[model samples]
Target chain A: MALVLQTVDLQKRFGGIVATNDVSLSIEKGARHALIGPNGAGKTTVINLLTGVLRPTGGRILLEGEDITDLEAHKRVHLGIARTFQINQLFPDLTPLETIGLAVSERLGMGGQWWRLVGSKSAVVEQAVEVLDRFHLADVMHERTATLPYGKQRLVEIALAIACRPNVLLLDEPAAGVPEAERHDILAAVAALPKDVTVLLIEHDMDLVFSFADRISVLVNGELFVEGAPEDVARDPRVKAVYLGEEADA
Target chain B: MMAAEESGDASRTLVAQANAALAARARWSPLEIAFWLAAAASIFLFPTKHLILTEIAILGLFALSLDLLLGYAGIVSLGHAAFFGFGAYAAGLLAKYHVVNEPVLALLASGIATMLLGFVTSFLVLRGSDLTRLMVTLGVALVLREIANRLEITGGADGLQGIVMDPILGRFSFDIYGHVAYVYSLIMLFALFLVARRIVNSPFGLSLRSLKGNPLRAAAIGIHVNGRLVAIYTIAAGYAGIAGALLTQTTQFASLSVLDFERSADVLLILIIGGTGYLYGGLIGAVLFKLMQDWLANLTPQYWQFWIGLILVIIVLVGRDRITRTTDPIRALVQRATDRVWSGVRGSG
Candidate 1:
């Protein structure tokens, strides 16, 4: 399989504090890869670096074999990379459909035309509705996204990422604030993404990770601990001592 | 998952095509179109004195320039009057010393001169937040006023005089009827409005709106937010300069008070009364504010400011949005009645 993305010795330091340290990883095309780590292990930082939100103190990132380390986040998005935040980053006043439609327009490289009520454009609105529907958000298409429940908000955020039509999607803790009852639904929706779309997911729940991810990379104290198939990683003694100890209690 | 993906892709494609079609058919918003039409009609239709119409047109253009920066670009400036005053002085000096004979050259000189000044100060203004930006703009205006006062060439407090604006387009000299001045101002106002409208409707304008809503998100989406803001701010300064030049040419004088805080305050008040982000709001607000002041001052000379102050207080107390919604309740009722009558006629036909 062709590798879609690779990070080479990525490092980020805030004075003496190392947020990310010599981290290197590769994502195969169309594969569901998981990045698992404890708190402060820099999972979100990694996402930021990949999406161009934060610059690395050292190292390089390659998308389709072209280095994009110096690219701005939005430019990276146009290059077929998109991400969702751990916290919902949405236009609070806009409808979910409108939010998605704006993303679609950006992805398609349309001029602003914002004052022109492009919201009524059937193709754009239809695309927005389709993404919403995939996440079961049709009824709330016209409703302000801020009014949606936490779980639904997460789904809408995901829909926005999908609206970009990026070749690689980075999901930062899709189930972070989700209620237990709605957690399964979130996992199932993410697991259902198109096979051609590569996903790099940062999830805390071992159950969701093991069931959904094809491969898992463990991180401890800003360093790579181990990486392998879920079953082997689960059985690894070091993994048990660190990640599994917390999982057993959950 | 497969079913959801299929539906999502299909709907996305459908929405894109539908949006493109709808966008193609959409016209300018009712508020904007109605405003310009009404303004144009009133200019030709109203029985006001010619000089007053001239003042209205000049003031309207000035307010519109401020609106471009504050309303559309989200740059809250309190010193825009400095550019206006600078343009007036520049044009007046040019005309006073026989530096330029043609009105068009004076106008271009005024605009380009202030634009260069704006470009120099834009870096300082662009680095600050709203409050800081306001202060920087106000500071610049203050400095310009002081400089004008100090310079003998600018005529100190006596103002720049002997500004005989040569015949516009080499015809229709400004006369006692104020016909040429009024018509010239009106045409320039209309032209500026068209350019402002075009700029605000373009991709660049949309980027401004996005930046206003969320700068971080805009940057994340690949926008060079700071560069765009600086460029727009400078463009707005150029508009302000032209407005100043128009006033000086039409009136044949440039006063130090043009750069005064009162001028800036009036522009801000006009924007507030009319609404922000709507191009025509500036014109409507200027006309209404000026009319109110003109009428009120004549009625109660000593208490004119007091009455106006009270009106502003009432507006703020009642809340701008709510008061705006209620401003034309009576007119709205009349409109509804007229609509029903028209529909009844059509139905009978």
Candidate 2:
């Protein structure tokens, strides 16, 4: 499979401390890739660099063979790259349906047409309803996003990113705040997405990472420790010592 | 299924009507549109009302200019009067000394001068938070006022007088009765409103709205947040300048009153009363404010300001947003009935 996004020799530093050091990684088109590390291992920094939220000290970001190192975050979004935050970034005053409508409107380049508002567009409204329904959010579609339960909020954020119809989707700790009961539903929704969309997930739950990731990359102290298929990486003693503890293995 | 479908159809019809009504209200109600049109119509019909209406028109345009930045772009300024005063003084000085023979050219010069001033002041606005921004803008206006006071050529504390606007288009004389002046001011105000409305509905305006709603989100989405704000500020300043020039052209005078804190406060109060983010809000506020002033002064000339302040406080206490909230259901019913009647007329046609 052709690679869709690849980072070459990425480096970032804060004062004297290096956050990401020469981290080279590639995400194959349509592959489900997971990046995992202990807290402060700079997994989020990698996501930030790729999404143009933060500039790297040194590195190149290649999207579909074109280097997009200096691109702004919004331009990257327009170029078919979208990322959900570790914390939800939703329009709190807007309903779930309204939030989705804004995203879809932006994706379709109709955001500028105030006279052609989102509520007036039947097709866009129906599509927003379908997206909310996919995550069992139809009941609360008209409810403010801030009023939804935490798990549902997380689901809505994911739904918003997906609604962009992006070729590549980035999810940062999508299940971090989710409850045990809803985790299955969340996983099923993620798994059921169209096969053409590539995903880069940052997840801490070992069972989730192992089951969902087509390939796993382990980061340690701002460096890549190892990357391989989930089973082989699970077997690696270094990964277990650093990422998967004895309790996790048991 | 039949009952559910019937209700769905009913609600859809209700919603479509509500949507249309809301759109109309958002554009300002038909009554307001008719009122302005009627007022414009009367400028020709009633010669006596022309001068007062022209002042109203100029002030309304000034208030609208402030609303463009304050209401839509979310840039609060306590010193917009700086641009107004500058434009008034520019056009007044030009006309007094016969530097410009053409009134339109003088008006144009006044606007361009104020835009240059705005371009310089925009950098100050870019670096400050909202509170800081307010103070800085106020400081800029105060400084400009002081400079005007120091310069004898600008009439200093006495204010510039005897501003003889050259014949508009080299034809209509600005008489003491203000017939030509009123027409000139109305035409200018209408043009500014059209331009303001067009800009507010444009792509740039949408970006400004997005920036207002969430700056961080706007930045993430690739909007140059600061750049958009500075550009909007400059445009609003240009409008303010034109409003100032119109005032001088109508009054045959330019005064320190244009730069006073009361002018800014009055505009702010008008925006609050009429509504914000809606184009008509500023114009409506101006008419309501000036008419109330006239009526109150007639009743209690000494305590008119006190009564106006009380009205403003009541408006703020009631929650401005709640006061302006759409009562869509009732309006929607009437709108649908009207729609049917219109379609019937079209059918006959």
Each candidate's root-mean-square deviation in Å? 5.1, 5.8
- Highest-DockQ candidate: 1
True contacts kept of 2: 0.16
Where does model 2 exceed 4 Å of error?
A1-30, A37-45, A55-71, A78-80, A91-168, A174-198, A204-208, A219-226, A236-250, B1-29, B41-49, B93-109, B150-155, B295-304, B325-349
**Clash totals in order:** 18, 1
Best by lDDT: 2
Tens digit of per-residue lDDT, candidate 1, span B1-349: 9998986686666565444433432334444457667766765686457688888888888889888888766889899899999888988988888898688778888888988887888888776689998999999999999999989999899888767778877876888768777777888888888778767755566567667766666655545667767777777888889889988998899999889999998899888877788687788888889989999899999999999888877767877778667867865675556556555767999
TM-score of each model's chain B: 0.86, 0.86
The prediction achieving the highest TM-score against the true structure is 1
Writing each residue's lDDT as its tens digit, candidate 2 over B56-169 gives 888898889889998788898888899999998988988999988688889988998898888889989886689998999899999999999889998889999877777998
TM-score of 2: 0.76
What C-alpha lDDT, on a 0 to 100 scale, does residue B336 get in candidate 1?
A: 59
Report the lDDT tens digits of candidate 2 across residue range A8-88: 999999889999999999999999999998888999999999988889999899999999999878788888888888987
